[model samples]
Structure formats: C-alpha cells, structure tokens
Target: MNATDRTPADLLRSALAADPARPLVTFYDDATGERVELSVATFANWVAKTANLLQGELSAEPGDRLALLLPAHWQTAVWLLACSSVGVTAEIGGDPAGADLVVAGPDRLDEGLACSGERIALSLAPLGRRFPAAPAGYADYAVEVPSQGDRFAPFVPVDPDSRALVVDGVELTEAQLVERARADAEALGLGPGARLLSGRPYDSWEGVSAGLYAPLAAGGSVVLCRNLDLLDADGLAKRVESERVTRTAE
Candidate 1:
C-alpha cells in the first residue's frame, strides 16, 4: 500500500495508478463453474458507478449507516469500496431497522425490508443480472447502477477519521480500517504481486480482511471463491495452479 494512503479508497486509487491493467479481483463460484477476472480499472469503474448511485440516487451522506447484507462475491467487494468512497459506514450483517440504507441480495430481501430508508436489491446472478421484477419497496441495483456515470466524485469529501465500517460489532474509522488492513496484510505475508485465494465468507472481520482488504492493501490481488467446499482436493489443487495463487485463506 502507498505510505500516503489514508483510506481504503486511497489504497484502491494507488493500485489503479500503479497498474490499471493488472488483475485485482478474480472470483469463482465452484458450484456453478463460473469464473470472472477484473482488472484494477474495470473494478474501479464498477466502484465509481456504484458510488454514484449511493451518493446521487440514494442520497447517502457521510456518516450514514448502510446495512450490507450480501454474500462473498465480486459485487460485494465492489459495494465495500463504493461505501468507502462515499464515506458511508458499512455494517455487515447489521440490523436493517437502524440503517440509513440497506443493500441486500435476493435471499435477504425480506430482512432488508426492515430498513425504512433507501433499499437496493441485487440479483447476484451469474453476470450481475437484474431481478425479473423489482422487489417491493426496493430499487434494482443491477438496473440502476449501469446508468450512473462511470466516474464518481462525492459532493462532500470523506473524512479519514470518520466511521467507515462496522463488522462483527466492531466499528472502525477509515484510517483505522486502512491501518488494520495493512497490518493484516503483513500478518498474512501478502506483499506486492502476491495472489491470495480466499474461501472465507463475509460474516466476520477476519473474512472481510482476508477476502478483500488485505490483498488490496498489500498491492496484491485475491481469488475469491464461493462454495469452495464443494471442490474436491484435486480440483482445488488444480485451481490453485491455474490461478497462480500464492497463498490460501480458509
């Protein structure tokens, strides 16, 4: 990570500036035999559009709480960074009733409806497809996000010391989050050019760190695997070799 990076968004910007073409996130759904690779620039575009949606359409402001009820998928990673860029405090598996906004996948739509504020639902389909019909009282993310500008600039600048994330009952400011991610990267032995394969779900701080933040803070990339347990030992080994993964996070 850059020494001057003060927030997770800064880390992503540094990565993009360093090598926009380099792969940043490689996602796999072993159960469905789906694989997707995103370059730093491509991922940044998604973050930009999503951030625009949050800031402009959803009216998300700094310090507003957003309950994020999504699984460990590529779109989840995008939303994490988008929240960072918008200065919204992302609460993983948090109570929707108390949030200013809620983003949920198909399975969690019922729970997400508890939030009275803006709600967005994701299909989480193979290619980020929209739901056949919008969920009641919720905007369809896949449809709304695409029309947003590819470049995003928040109306209000994010404060480095503002609360940025809440996971597992722990609240962390943007600076603290970046610091912890850097430390976690070092502890995991991830460095520049390292490729980490992670099978952890996004239900805890450890899972979030290992799956996204650590690799990002280390100027490395991650191979995020969903339903990884479904893969056999030999299949796992072959995947490791094929993806050139340097480390494994269970």
Candidate 2:
C-alpha cells in the first residue's frame, strides 16, 4: 500500500496476516542489556495501544506537532506508529519556537518550554538509560500510550498528497516519500520476512515511513540498530549476518 493509503494499523495487520509467527522486531534490550524477540501479532497490539494513547487520550490533532528526542529503541517503534494513527505531525528539532510538543532534546526542550510556554503544550519523554522516570513534570510516554489501551476512534483517511512528516521546515508529502522508499526496497529485492537495518535513530517518521513501514507494508521485516557507536564495522557486519538482514536503509 502507498503511504497515504497505508496506516500504521495497516502495516501491522499485513504483517500478522502474512506470518503471525514471524519475528517482527528482534530487539536488543539496552536496559537489561539482553536480546529479545517479538512476533508480528505482539507488535501489532503494542502499536494499536500506542495509537489509542495519542489519539484517544492525548487529544492530538492533525498538523499538531510532536517532538521525539528519544534514543533508538523498541518504544521508539510505538511512538512513531502512535503519531501516524493520530495524524499528528511528528518532528525532530525542526522548529523549537513553533513546536506544540517536545521530548528527549533536553536543552531544546528547556528552551522550548520557556519560549513556547503555553504554546508548547504536551511533552512525551519515555524513560530509559540514565533517565529513571518521566523527568517529573513531563508526561510519561509509556504511561500515556499503553494506558490508552487498544480501542480507538476511527482513523481519518490521510490525503495522498498531504504532508505527513516534517523536519527543519522541509515538508514532503507522505505519498512522495513512501513511493520513493517503496521503489528502493523493490529495486533492492526485499521480500516477505526480509530484514532491514538502519544505522540511524528511529524516532523520526523517516525511519518508519521509509524503513519499517515500507518493508512490512511489502511483507518484510524491519530491524533497527539503536546504538551505532555500539556497533562498529565489525559489530555491524556480525549483527546483519546474525539477524539475516537483507538490506539496510541509512
């Protein structure tokens, strides 16, 4: 399915139908520092609950802004899908002055919280690593999402030519970006159960639209390398081989 035609729910449903037993994400736990695996069905439910949070509980709207300063990890997957299901514009440090929501980028957040103040409304900082909890005042991403559960209001049909993601004032229609990504995956010969790795942060919608969503939309698997520094050349080579990754989108 095309980007405008596709939803995060669409991808999850497709993945499950294709092979419910297949491993959708084989994540390396940065917290406990262990390797873990999740099936397509499991991830589908996780994504749905996330969507429920942002849309049902948070009251996020289309064109509303959400910032992600999160490290690349499994929860990153949940948030990206959450944004899509709600039609909220997810950004990564594009315009601190105009942002309605903020997360992760602590310094930018501090400045934004003061600058935007009332304009800067909700903040989603999921806890991990040195961060123990939701940083006190900031709303908890984990608590917000899963608490919302799986049921949600019906999704709005996204405009094919509409801009779905933003970064530094650049606005590319969801169709344009997803089409480009789909073409690349086809040319690279990605297929069912194929694994894709990206050496970049998964917080941005790019990683979802162009990476995970594209592949699973085409019945392929998406794996993320959250820590690049942790994966040097040798480490990367071993990871791909071990994970059976067919290609990478950097």
Candidate 3:
C-alpha cells in the first residue's frame, strides 16, 4: 500500500478486505469470560455511522472538542477512530465536566452523573432502549443514538497542517504527526490484520497519535488496555494467546 494514500480510515478498509470474516474485535467483558466478537467491516460501519450521528444530531463540526470517556476496550477504539476519520477533535478525559460529549464507562456512570455540573454527561449501555434520561443537568448518551444510521456523510476537509490536537496549550497538526508516524510504521512493515495490544496511557497526544492512530494508519489494529491489573494473569494470558497480538509499544 502506498503510504501517501493512506488515512486512519484505511485501516478498517484494508482489514475488511483481507480479513472481513475474521474476528477483528474480540472483547472479554468480565472474569466470567463472556466474549463478544465484531468483524472489521461491521465495526467500520458502526464507526462511520457513529461519526455521522455526531455530526448530524449533535452538530459536531470539524475540530470540535469531544471528550471520550469509555472503559470498554473495543468501544474506545471505535470512538477514537471514528473521531479521527470524521475529522472531529477529541480529548480523552475521565471527568466529563468540560467536554461536549461524554461516553462514560459503566462503572463511572453514577459518579459521572453526580459530578457533572453543567456538563452533558451520559451512560452508554447496549442493554436497553436509549430513552433520554434527564439526570439533573446532563443528557443521556443513549445507545440508540449511535444506532440511527450506517452511513457517514463524509469526512470534513481540514488542512493537513491544521491544529488537530492540543495538550497543555501545546498544539500540533494531525497531518504533520500522523504522516510522520505512518511513514515509520510502513518502514517497519506493520500492516493489515496485525493485532497490536498496547499498554499505554492515552491521556497524552503522543499515545493517541503514535500509540493508537499510527498503527491504524499502517493498517494494523491497536488494542488498548488501560488497566491490565484487574484481569487475572491467566485471563490476560488467554486473551493474548487467542488474539495473537503481535506487537506492543510503550
């Protein structure tokens, strides 16, 4: 694949072509060992749909700062990629206080609701209808909102040199960094169907840019696990072995 032609979205494209029927995402939810598998195309479509929903429903313009606050491994990846591909600016934060949208984790639901002062926070669950929940001051992040459609309108055109990420008031363009990382990843021969299980703190732009999107830019999957300590060693081992995770970078 030509490096210049690739964007973060192409990761899903390549994976769908090479391993469409293969399990692209296998998430182990609990110690009970219940697992869920979502194919590459299916996941890609969901992301596209989600991106479109954010744009149409929430009026999320390009470079709009969105706070992604989910703990589920697969859910996080999908949100991040959707934002990247859709050209929406994102910041990962536990507290949804200043964010435009908060994708709260199941465990953080109550705490997030309680502390969300003048912030639109919500719980994301796959179990029920996405009825709007007026939890005092925040809006509900109903699962149905992300399920309304399956088509992304189109990626908003942003200058490659446009400031896409901000950290501690330090800003950088997405095209500048991602292009560089994409070059390095290609030089290293990391490509489609490769499972990259990563253990890195994503609160920083480097982790998100290099540790996450760079791998995807190379047509490889980057699975993020913020806290592996909670999972028993054996359970983690089983996941690693079965996933055939081929790489890791700090």
Candidate 4:
C-alpha cells in the first residue's frame, strides 16, 4: 500500500483496501455478446481463488513460468494477476513447451497439451465454464477454481526484483512492472478514480499497460473491450460516455 510497494498483487490489494466497492474491470466481448463488471472485491476474490488453485493444486512457486495462452478477456486478466499473487511469472503468448504451467483458452487446447508441466483449460464462456468434459491430460479451470479458497497466501515470499512478466520479447521484474505501469498511467494521463476504455489487445506492452497494469497503478478502473473493431466510432463514443470513461486507449 505504500509508495514502495511494487508487486502487482500487492498493488491490487491496496486498491481493494482503498475502495473495495469501486468498479475495477468492466469487460465487453462484442464478438460473444457478453458484458461483465467486477468490483475490486469481486476481482480480488477471483484472483485469490485462482491463486489458490495455482499454488495449492499445482504447487506453483516463485519465479515459475506460467504460459498464458489467452486473449484479451476478463478471465485472462484474472490469470495474470493470479500469477502475480503466487509469484509465478506470467508469460503472455509464450511457448508452452518451456513453461512450468500453461493456462489456455478454448482455441489453444491442442497446443496446451504439449506443455511440460501442469495444464489448465478455460472455456472462456460467459461465466468461465469448463469444457463439456475435461480435456485430456488437463485440469478444468472453471471446475477446479471455484473449489479453491477465497483467500490465498504464498508458500514463499515473492521477490520484487524477480521476473514477473514477459511480453513482446521483454521480461520485467515485479518492481519494474509496477514502475512501467505507473509511468504508462502518467503517460496516458490517468489519475485517481479515472476510468479507461481500452480496445487494445493484450499481446503487446502498450495494450497490457492500458488494459490492466496502468489502471491498477493509477488507482483507476478499466473498461476492456474485445472485438472493438466491430463497433462503429459513434457506438464506441457512446459506450465511453455511458461508462463514464475518463480516458481511452485504442
């Protein structure tokens, strides 16, 4: 909660402590006709449960690599933070073959099977449903996550100087991640209580900063839109107004 705090999970804990009822992430998937809003409390609950699943079930340790084979959706966001909570390094679009764990979306199920360690598949449905039947050689994320405790405590202390994220050929430590996020927030003109509407995909640093890290660092919220290209400019503008978006990153 202090200015020196750097880990993403710690930052999120600060956000929840500061304003648990405030909207943290408002997600819209135009392609799927889905919309979901999560307050800090709800988002943290999801993160905690997912973290517990990663640590308690999978035995994730600090500095472990977690390949995130997911798109820019609410569940993917949860997985990213959950990794931070458990001190695992989240590698966006990284190769599963080298990972300690792989969390894949429906489209990546086949690819995920080739992963080295533990594997979990997400249907990425409206409510994070599991596959009709558990995938071969993989755990069902939705089925397992809900059974995890709502609170999570890491088995070992997470080092702020340790690698926390890797994206677009760049690896960042937990402290560096927070530092970059805070800088990106300032660059985007984000401030306390600001709400950002972002249509950027999560594969790049800019997109990840805008959609997740920056807002969290700035004490702001985000409205993350997938398939945003399908929306006309007028419609996008209207949603921004309706959502009270203070900034927009496209």
Candidate with best TM-score: 1
Model 3 clash pairs are: none
lDDT of each: 0.95, 0.59, 0.58, 0.92
lDDT of 4 by residue, 77-143 (tens): 8999999988999999989999999999889989987788999999889977778998888889989
Ten residues in sequence with the least summed lDDT for candidate 1: 1-10
Residue-level lDDT tens digits of model 1 in 1-250: 6798999999999999999999999999988888999999999999999999999999999999999999999999999999999999999999999999999999999999999999999998888889999999899998899999999898998999999999998889999999999999999999999999999999998999999999999999999999999999999999999999999997
Model 3 agreement with the true structure over 1-250: per-residue lDDT tens digits: 3445434555556656666676555544453334455676777877877677666666666766666655435666677666666666656663456655555555555555534332333443343235355555445545445555776655466445544554434455656556755765665456765676655555665556444565666666655555555677796677688778776544
Off by over 4 Å in 1: none
**Pairwise TM-score winner, candidates 1 and 4:** 1
RMSD of 1: 0.7
Give the TM-scores of the predictions, in the order they appear.
Answer: 0.99, 0.76, 0.72, 0.98
For model 4 the TM-score comes to 0.98
What is the Cα-based lDDT of residue 137 in candidate 4? 84
Q: What is the C-alpha local distance difference test score of candidate 1?
A: 0.95
Model 2 residue 17 CA deviation (Å) reads 3.0
Ranking by lDDT: 1, 4, 2, 3
Residue 148 accuracy (lDDT) in model 4: 89
Task: Return the top candidate by lDDT.
Answer: 1
